[model samples]
Target: MGRIQMLNSYIDNLTMLQSLNLIDQAVSDGKHIHHSVVNAGKIVLMQKDVQLRESVNSADIINPDGQAVIWASKLLGRPLKERVAGIDLMENLVELAHQKGYKIYCLGAKEQVVSKVIEKYKQNYSKDIIAGYRNGYFSKEEEPGIAKDIAESGAQILFVAISSPKKENFLYDNRQALKSVNFIMGVGGSFDVVSGLVKRAPEWMQNIGLEWFYRFIQEPRRMWKRYLIGNSKFIFLTFKEKFKNKP
Candidate 1:
């Protein structure tokens, strides 16, 4: 499939279903795939950070994860149908794993969150495809053993829920060692969402791209700084790029 090249990375040309199909094919063929998301704001911010830029560009599949990305696509006259959030993609992959009887491994999130997500998956899916899971709080020294464990489990699809940059770097650094897996997706905060430890914004809020606002209200102490400070910088950088016609 042809991809849409944004500033620093290429967003996958496929829709959600098409992306899922590609992942299924990769699993069937035993190919390693690293998937990430690119939003306009994120793209603009990462443009100034060489390491983050390289990591994002190296991802095998970069989906337009936020409404800002969809809006940017429309501005460029290549309108994406919808915002393909990473969490939604992670859930879809789990469903596909269940249908295909593929062993799945989840790495990231707190121990309780990961456990709860696994339990929720067992309750929800038609097939039990989860092979193993580990919390995201492990030390750097533990990664090699964890990688070995996933490989030994024969899991084909690995869902990683750690935060960005770090998760991308982990996959990049461990891709060779994780030969048993066909797909490794960086699904930020997905485990928390899936386990219902964190509530998503209402559909209306999400539709209007006010989901961040809802989150800010929900956890003012925690989210206020991220939204107030980080989001402001993101917006400023985005506009700077727009006016300068440069990333």
Candidate 2:
């Protein structure tokens, strides 16, 4: 996989299988790989959020999580191979954990949501694949302790499903405490989908880059600002970058 700069961020141009292979290699070699995925909204936010930029940019593997991001990359003359959606990556990693006899720790989502995810994972894969789990409802002071617990849980893979910036910061801040974990990733809202609390867009919508709209329609009041405003800003920024980079 190669890393390319686009839209003021770095994205690893990797297919889903490539990403899974890299993670598997890291885990097998007992090395640490901090993973992150960037979408249109996050790229726009990172323009003004220095910490978020640092946290995401510093990751060992950064994937394009939004189809809009893929389109923007092409517009800017740096086309990506595919969009590696966070939920899809998480699902593949869970299977990887099962196949490789690795354990994963799930941290994020509501209490019932995370619980249901763990239960479902146990049902789908074996319960042995779960190292530990906790709801994403801790305070700032609890962050260190939570990281410590995951580190000691014998988990080879760690997935944080909390919201952006917060999840990014938590993993960045506690990187030292979680040093033993072989792979670390931020999987926003993945638990909700896994727990059947949310529905994913159809394949055609995803292929056409309307997955965000599908989500927005599900809860317009909650997602209008995120999708509508955020996407507009992203489009503006992408064009701005394209002009700025002109030779």
Candidate 3:
């Protein structure tokens, strides 16, 4: 019998290539794919949030979406080799979708942001594989019809850029209705980055895991709370785990 893994503790880290390969397999097999990321900090925080934990753990592909996760993997001597940022994965998937002639459905970002993202994709790809796109803001009551439209559009891949638990919950709730889709990725804020609404960190900043600082500097008012508070809590929890030897 297959062993039952600990949802709270087990780190299923994957590099960019490994993640891309899984996406390829899922697309080829016509299987619904749900994916999320978990770092050392998120793992411990998720222990208390059962629904969030279950949703992430249930993902068909779970990547180490943060640098802290890559660091932890190396410390554990089972290094993931690289970080697979969600934004990069989304771009890679778009390339694959265009090459494979797969229709894509994009859902998330503000209305204008979504429009700009679609326009950018068209400009870059020029092959017309994007079946449709919708802004992130929608009444819960309208979700059923929206899902139906996407399924009928014959879109093979669906990219959900709605932030965090919302995107995760959407996938968990609508996996059945998304039957027409073979790949569904929860890509938070990737659309904004791709559409040039937000700037990405420089190579040096990203390499040293100071990307958050770069963002904080760019939009201090909006990001101060997230980076200053959320990041500090994340660091504290990571150290807590280290002292506890949870890994």
Highest-scoring model, TM-score: 2
List model 1 lDDT by residue over 80-128, tens digit each: 7678888888888887887789888999999999999999888888436
The residue-by-residue lDDT of candidate 2 on 186-220, one tens digit each, is 99999999999999999999999999999999999
Model 3: pairs clashing at backbone N, Cα or C within 3 Å? none
Candidate 2 residue spans exceeding 4 A from truth: 245-247
The local distance difference test score of each candidate is: 0.79, 0.95, 0.77
Clash count in backbone of candidate 1: 0
Taking every candidate in turn, the Cα RMSD to the unseen true structure, in Å, is: 2.4, 1.0, 3.0
Better of 1 and 3 by TM-score: 1
How much does candidate 3 score in TM-score?
Answer: 0.89
Clashes of each: 0, 0, 0
Model 1 misplaced regions, further than 4 Å? 76-78, 245-247
Estimate the overall C-alpha local distance difference test score of candidate 2. 0.95
The collision pairs in model 2 are none
Residue 91 of model 2 has an lDDT of: 94
Best by lDDT: 2
TM-score of 2: 0.98
lDDT for position 244 in model 3: 74
Ranking by lDDT: 2, 1, 3
